[model samples]
Target: MVEATPELTSTSDSPALAVSVLQMLRTATSVQHKALEARLPLTHADLDRSLYTRIIEAYYGFHVPLQRHIDQFVSPQACDPKRYKVAALIKDLRALGLSDGQIDRLPLCCDLPRLQTQGHLLGIMYVIEGATLGGQVLRRIIADRLGIEADSGGEFLDVYGRDTGRRWKAFLKQLADFDQPEYNGDVVDAACATFASFERWLDRAGVLL
Candidate 1:
């Protein structure tokens, strides 16, 4: 692994970038939810179950990835070359003023087994990996600005990047190629909105402070 000195890029005026990334994350999640929603037979019981799944999946999808990022930041010696993405994410969270406590709790909100069973695991991974990639870029910015190695505070970023890359890529490809008979854009829109809501929550909590 190459230990490059920290190089900070300018993210002072990059709210739009955050919005774009968050939007992508949200839309993909909604696609999975909408698919499940359509599958529920229309009976009251089935409707209830479907609704439950949609709500649960949506909530879990939104928080887990962010939680993973928080977990990665506090640990040292965990960052491998691949975890550059993770480092970048910590930068974003720090920029947002997210406290260690809030960041740490994000994982508990996610359901690991159900995430895989519902086929939304990929979507969740997409959100996490995307943030991680963004984080790497952000870390460079931090390093450049601070005149230190980009991953000075967080090392796990490199570790996660290599480990999650292949699986994340496969998931995205699967999503892009997914050919379902029924197409629902509204669900995608809903997910985007959901993510936006969560982002706002972090902002309000002074995670960016």
Candidate 2:
């Protein structure tokens, strides 16, 4: 789970029935958030190249199908290319010595959560965009412990690079449009489902802590 930093949790300027979407998402998905964080091995002190690669591999598998699915709903104005992380994951895999062919041969997650509306999509995006934060901490850990750098096999850990904050804020700004109470259920369900899906996928891939 991505840490719920203040930036991600601050109350939106616009209150939808006196409760911001951030607040609802944070409160409702707290349990699922902690569960996934506890199970992910990214923070383990002994994280090695093999273990790290497995983790990235699992993420690549998840995002390949996920990105394709989500693109269908995101409008041109809302679809920021920088928000996409699959390419970064692929770059890291290549730096780790995987050939393009091997990457193409990699398996993808099939049982993704259903997204019926843009509200559900927002919840899904919230989870995905929020996870970028863990990368900031991960970059340092992998650098000190595994001798990996963004240009090497750790690009995925710091996908947004120096602009992570800008990207996150952009996502938050986008969320402002869905602050209404009516959208709350889909947002929370999608957020929880995303965490569950990612954790279950990693566990199935044998990469969980």
| Top lDDT model | 2
The alpha-carbon lDDT assigned to residue 149 of candidate 1 equals: 43
What's the lDDT for all of these models?
Answer: 0.39, 0.84
Model 2 clashing residue pairs (backbone): none
lDDT of 2 by residue, 1-209 (tens): 53443323334784434667887788777778787777787788778889888888899999999998888777667777877889999999999888999999988999787788988899999888887787798799899998899999998889888988898888898898768878777888888788888888988999887
Candidate 2 total steric clashes: 0
Q: Which stretches of candidate 2 lie over 4 Å from their true place?
A: 1-17, 75-78
- Residue lDDT tens for model 1, 1-209: 11222323347685422223223444455453343324322222323323322322333334556445444543545423442344444443443445656555543323221221112333334444544544455335434543334244333233354545674565456555542313223323433444444544443333322
Error of 1 at 2 (Å): 27
Q: Which structure among the candidates has the greatest TM-score?
A: 2
